[model samples]
Target chain A: MRIEAGRASRRYWQDLWTYRELLGFLAWRDLSVRYKQTALGVAWAVIRPAFTMLVFIAFRKLAALPPSGVPDAILVLSAVLPWQLFSTAFSEVSGCLVGNANLISKVYFPRFLVPLAAMATSVIDFMVTLAMLALVMAWFGYAPTDKVVMLPLFVVLAACLALGAGVFFAALNVQFRDFRYVVPFVVQAGLFVSPVAFTLGDVPEAWRWLVALNPVTGIIEGFRWCLLGANAPFYPLATLTSVAITLAMFALGVWYFRRTERGFADVI
Target chain B: MSDIVIRAENLGKKYRISHETAQPYRTFRETLAKGFQRRRGSAHQEEEFWALRGVDFEIRRGDVVGVIGRNGAGKSTLLKILSRITEPTTGYVDLNGRVASLLEVGTGFHPELTGRENVYLNGSILGMRREEVRRKFDEIVSFAEVERFIDMPVKRYSSGMYMRLAFSVAAHLEPEILIVDEVLAVGDSAFQKKCLGRMEEVSAGGRTVLFVSHNLGTLLSICDKGILLDAGGCVANGNIRSVVKAYQQKAGSGEDLAPNLIGGPLKSVTFRQVWINGEKLGGSQFSPGEPIQIRVVGNAAEHLPEAVFTLSLYAEGGRLFTVEDRPMTLHQGEFSLQVEIPAGLLRPGDYSLALGARTAAELATPHDWCWGTDLASFELNEVWSANCKRDLHGMINVNARFTRENAPILERAAT
Candidate 1:
């Protein structure tokens, strides 16, 4: 490998692949450390989304919104699962660089893997919650179309959206720790802005486009369509827009992260 | 793909020191304020500080090279660049093989994780693959001697156990090139010996090693090549002995390098000057088996019934032995005392002298009227003899007579 003034080594991506086991170990470490001290352990994964589903069910009843013909609980959950995954992954990715300051400053690896490992931890939590989602569906006697097979694709989309924004913020956090405050504000405010509690159809048609700009909007809608089958709403243009925006954010995140990554060890 | 495993060319690193704030990181408010100031025609209050500049070196496979210098001499910056922990601002470095650096031990260890789990986590952070760690797992655990606590959380282990476990994992790593800095100073003497032995074994296996430490003795024993950095530049490089000699000479000279003789007002006497062999003492080499005289010149403000003079000899910063002359009455005036070390008392090595003076009554207490540590440093060169090998280990040497005796032998009776 050649280390030069202005560019990372040409083998950075190859090194990233070669160090895949590190990615796994780091993610496993976070997961293990996270659960080791907690009273509920991994059960928190299931409990978190389950509690959010309950809150949305009460909101649905109080708002007296039009039903989309599917079970009210399943409707909010399909979107909530993807939304929780995106939010958790985003928060983890954004703050990971500072969180692993010891590793970043002392060792040499593809530093991007630090945030990527955080995403992996969230992905593991999402899997556990997905299992819980299935059990909830069974409890509600709801079985859907073969479209559920395509569910993994939407999951990937949510991951891309999370990683793209997370990487961008993670890099920013390293420079100006002020982003530490900005990140939580973005995640908390994001829940209400995205269609987690209500379907996209509930919004006034004139303001729907603005809501779709969140990038998570299209992925969550796609998730609902995949789970709710023919009864759920599927907007191809909005879904396509979310995919495009997610890809752009992913590219932009990586570009900004790479431009700033070299100085991380020095400043962090 | 020549024999050289690493090469650096004209490397440099520059950091901007902002006078506005001493914090290592900038906050959003400071950045915003700076932006407004830029618009108002105020020049940025920042100075470019080059921690390292125009440095170059190369190392071949199996070369154990030592990097030595005073503090802030760019020793760490140079190592950080070589290890790719940070990038150099100018020039470039090329490495022909995989490199693993241990700038610190247990860098990624989690206190909540058990020792067994941490081994895997720490190994991966140090660039070892899961399969590699798995294969060497037993060896690492046994080497650390924490077999009974492998499943226990590392936070529960004693600090010694932590260091042992950390060092053991590093010792088992098989990177093509290894870089380490000041880690051996943590463990006990026996553990340090084991670590030094392990390092020797690593070098023997033909792996390139770059090491930095303040212990000159350890450096001399392990490194065949040396690079001396002075003020961010390479002053000398080549054979370890000569580079070390150059460093010692540079460190030994200068105005403040002289003996420290300042004392409190409670003292009635003080050593104004010291000499060796009737010459002003300085950093110089001396031969063994020669009568070496250290003379101390001092003045007494009042008469002391019983004044004692003492001199201590130290090797590598550790006191080797001390001698005291018989107490004698002193008049109120200048007085001088001389202590001579007779022949065949010291082995070939480096040493320093500390001078002390006190009344016999004060000698019983820790208070000495006149005291100065490291008043002078000298080296004893090896003198080849017809019957003895040169450079025999230990601090002091003595003369002994060997004789053979003939006697009657007694037979053992079986019962």
Candidate 2:
């Protein structure tokens, strides 16, 4: 490999692929260490979506909102799982770089793998909740239509959206510690702002497009529609907007991350 | 030629030091505040400092090269550039094969993970593939001597066991060109010897190695070539002996020598000066069996209770001995202390001294003391020693009396 002035090697991507096993190791380390001594262990993953489902149900009842034709339990859960995935992954990725300061400063690998691997723990947690969602659907006797095949695509979309913003903030957090404060606030506010607990239709007709500007909105809405079928019809224009914004953010995040990648070790 | 495995052309790394900010990273509010302050006509105090500049070198496929320098001489920057941990600001380095750097051991070892899990984790972090770690799993465990506790979390292991485990994984890394920092400074003497032996085997196997260490003896023994860096520039590069000689000369004389106050003073006690035999040491060389007198002068900012001064001697790869002076009370003023090492106490070898001062309250934390390692060094020349003909096996100098099996007790006692 040739290391040039102000640039990495010509085979940077190849270098990343050569170190692919590191991703698995790092991911495994995080997952195993996360719940090592905790009483609940992997059960912690199920608790969040279940708790969020209960809270949303109580919220809908208190507000006396009109429910879509689908059962409230499945509607809130299907959306909550994806939202949980995005938020948890987003926060994890943003903090991964700072958390592994010793590794970044001492060793050389594709630095992005640290944040990318961070997504795995959240993905595992999402899978746990996905299994819980299946159990809930079985309890409510609500199976999906053929549209369920599209579920993986929306999951990918949610992952891309999380990774994009997470990578961007991860780089930003290295330079300006203020981003640490910014990330949790955005993730928390994102739940109410996006259509996780409430459908995009709940917003006024004119503001639906604005609500869809949040990349997670389109992903959550699309995910819910896949699970609930005709009962949870999503606005096509909003989904397109969400997809566009997610892709754009992914591009912007990667561009910014690469641009600032070299300085990470020095500053961090 | 294809035999040349690593080459660098005019490599340099520059860092922008901002006097306005004391920390490496800046808060967003501080950045905004700086912008506003700049608009108010205050000048910015940013200076460009080159950590490594115009360093050019090449290494053949099997050369074992040592990088030697004092503090802030940019040895680390050069290694970091070669290791690809950081990019240089000017020029480039072309590495012919896979390069792995052990800047520190256990780079990514999680304390919460078991020893078995950490080996895999650390192995992959050091750039080994999973299959490679799996293949060497038993070897690493046996080398670390933690086979029985492999499933136990590392936090529960003794400090020696932890360091051994960490270094074992690193020792097994088989990159074509390996770059290592001073990771051997930890662990016991036996373990350090084992590590050095493994390194020698690596060099013998025809893989290129670049090592950085403060132990000159280890460097002279392991490396045939050396690069000496001074003030961010390569001053000497060639045969190991000559480069080390140049480094010694640079560190020994002129304005850089004597009474070296490294990194300024610490806490309330400011080390003002140091002297050897009533003269500034300046890295002087002394004959073996010669008494070395060292004097330390310092001033306390306030009344200090039970302040202890210590001087430690290090040789070969370990600290041989440490002597602590009596705890004395100082009433906020300058004071001088003298330590005399009588003749016949030191062998014919090179040794470094570490000076430390701490109060009783800070005794528990070793890092909290005002200390410096290799602060001022002296060499005991064998050629000039009276006991040069005697064969010595240990680090210290001690005389032995041998008696015949039938020797009379009265004759032995009279002698």
Candidate 3:
């Protein structure tokens, strides 16, 4: 192996690809350890979004809010699936670097793998939540149109947005621990603002564009459109904006992560 | 000649040494206060410390190189730079073929994971491919001798078992170059011996190995070449014997004679120097059945009404044998203490002396007034005499007198 200093060295990405097996092992370790001691086991993954869906359903019923013409449970579950994935990915990825300080300080691998593998656990949890969403749709006697085939693309888009935000925060979290406190607030606040409980149509027409800035806003709505059928509004411009924002954040996140990657061992 | 497997030229690593203690996750209030302090020009100053500087070396294939240094002597920094855990501030190193570094055993082993899982995890962390780990899995499991509990979580394993499992995985790693740092210090002596045997086997297989350790005997025995680091620079690089000898000489030179004063000067007393047989002690070697006199010199800023001076002798394995603890009142200014050891009291082995002083006021508390650890070291060798031979059994020597029962009395031997 040839070792060199500086950020522009070409071996970094190649090293990442070379160490792909480590990424899989780390992700497996995280998934196995996550539910090891808990009584609920993997049920905790579904319990979180299930509880949130119920609370949102009650709130919608009490407020007598105008329904988006889809079953409230199905609507809430579809949006919650993608939103939970984003939130979990964000939180887990942001803390991954610091959480695995022992591995980072002692070993040589692409530092990006830590956060990327951590995000993999969140992806597994997203899969479990997706299964629960399918069951919820079945219980409500809702049949998805052929548009549901696009659900995977929306999930990928959400993952991209989460990973971008995660990589950015994971790197920042190492330098300034203040992000440890900042990330939770962002995740919690993001849940309310990203249209998880209600559709984007519930918001005023002028403010809909503002909501599109949340990167996940387009993803969650796209999920509702795909699963809840064509009646669910698909704002082409808003989705484009969200996709652009997600890609930009991902680019910036990867750039910032790589830029600061070398100093991680020293600072962390 | 074998190919040069590793070559490092002018490698330097600079670290920012902050005067303040490192705290993880500082609260916003502290950060804000520090920011304000920085704006007002009262920020804590940081100095650039070069952990490694201009370190140049080459190791050919199949070379077992030992790295020797005192603490903070950049031994670990060089290993870290070589392992690529940390980048050098300047220069570069060319390493041929796959490189695996075992900076510490079980680098990524999760406590909750089973022994089998951890073995694979640790192997991959050390740069082994999954297929390779699988092929070597049974060998690792058998070598670790934890087959019965392979499925059990490692948290349930004894520390020795954990270390063995971790070391076995690392040892089985077939990387062309292996960099190990002080891992043999763990585990019991038997396990340590096993690890040494494994390392010897690896070197015999004609692979490059870079070993960093404080155990000079083991390092000298296993390695053909040695690199000595002192203050972030390569001081000696040659055959293991001479480099180890130079390192030993440097360590024994009494350059750090002044006792590290604990707390502040106001507490009470501080040790200045220790002497043996009217000469300043500097880790000198001695022989068994020899009389020795030790003198401790120190300063007492204020009169100590009730001070207890204690001298402790420690064996190589850190077994403490208190030689003396005398209570004496010391007036202000310099004070000297003398202790005598009789002949045949110490066996043939290495020992260290620790000096400490405590006051009556602090006797009930746990803290000591002033203390110095490893102040001096001396080795005792076995010597033969006309009448009797030196004993070579244990750390202590006992002079026993015997008389025959129900028989004619024998003449006493000359003293």
User: What local distance difference test score does each model get?
Assistant: 0.84, 0.85, 0.83
As for candidate 3, its clashing pairs are: none
lDDT tens readout by residue for model 2, B316-399? 556888999887887798888899888877777767777787777456754335776666666676764454533345667667
List the candidate 3 regions with Cα displacement exceeding 4 Å: A7-9, B24-44, B255-415
Best by TM-score: 2
Q: Which stretches of candidate 1 lie over 4 Å from their true place?
A: B257-283, B290-343, B351-378, B384-393, B399-415
Which candidate gets the maximum DockQ versus the true structure? 2
Query: Candidate 1: which docking quality band?
Result: medium
lDDT of 1 by residue, B1-415 (tens): 4898889899899988889887878998999999999999899998998988888888999999999887788898888888888999999888989899999988899999999999999998898888999999999999888999999999999999999999888888899999998787667767878888899999999999999976666787789999999888888999988887787767655433333344443377766666666655545667676878777777788898887777888665356788887888989999888788886787777667777767765555664466666556566777835333334556666566887669857788987
Best to worst by lDDT, what's the order? Answer: 2, 1, 3
- Give the candidate order by descending TM-score: 2, 1, 3
Better of 1 and 2 by lDDT: 2
Which lDDT tens digits does candidate 3 get at residues B158-203? 9989999999998898778999998987788677778889999999
Pairs that collide in candidate 1 are none
> How many residue-pair clashes does candidate 1 contain?
0
Residue A39 local lDDT, model 2: 96
lDDT of 2: 0.85
